[model samples]
Target: MTTNEHINSGEWPLWEIFIRSRQGLDHKHVGSLHAVDAQMAIENARDVYTRRMEGVSIWVVESKHIHASNPADAEAFYDPANDKAYRHPTFYNLPDELKHM
Candidate 1:
């Protein structure tokens, strides 16, 4: 069946795939796939997006479960943080013993 036909058939749910290449790294969205369930989605994502074993971990989330802010309201929602200079650490004076920080 064509891609559109398969999607419209409702036989599979769309999943968003995220991969972490190594330990301590954040999982980044790579792509998406369609599957019958979460386990199948995870397996399919690993196979499709990590053929060369680039990822040490994978996460598959149903597209329907994700909620995101509208891009148009980004400035109104996030711009307020930019005006708060005290939230930053530029003025902080750490002790000499805190060299790692």
Candidate 2:
């Protein structure tokens, strides 16, 4: 059967997987997979993504739970931030000894 048929047939739901590599500080989206539940999704992600023993942690989130901003509304959505110069680090003056700053 086609992918749509499988999904509509009450089969496993799609899950988005994020993996934190051993050397990484944050989890990055690796790929997606279909699983019965969250527990199964994590296990499946480990097997599929961490087979090479590269990942230190795995996060599985249901596709439906993810909410993202619309690309078409980018200007309107982020325009407010541009006016708030204080929110940016460059707006402030730092001491000369603050090497990182």
Candidate No. with top lDDT? 2
> Could you tell me which 10 consecutive residues in candidate 2 have the lowest summed lDDT?
1-10
Question: How many angstroms is residue 48 displaced in model 2 relative to the true structure, after the best TM-score fit?
Answer: 1.2
- Over 1-101, each residue of candidate 1 has an lDDT whose tens digit, in order, gives 44356567866778899999965479999999988778988899888999987798999888878999999999999998997999889789999888777
Stretch of 10 with least lDDT, candidate 1: 1-10
lDDT of 2 by residue, 1-101 (tens): 44456567978788999999989999999999998778989999989999998799999998878999899999999997987888877867788888954
**lDDT for predicted candidate 1 compared with the true structure:** 0.85
In model 2, where do residues sit more than 4 Å from their true spots? 1-8, 79-87
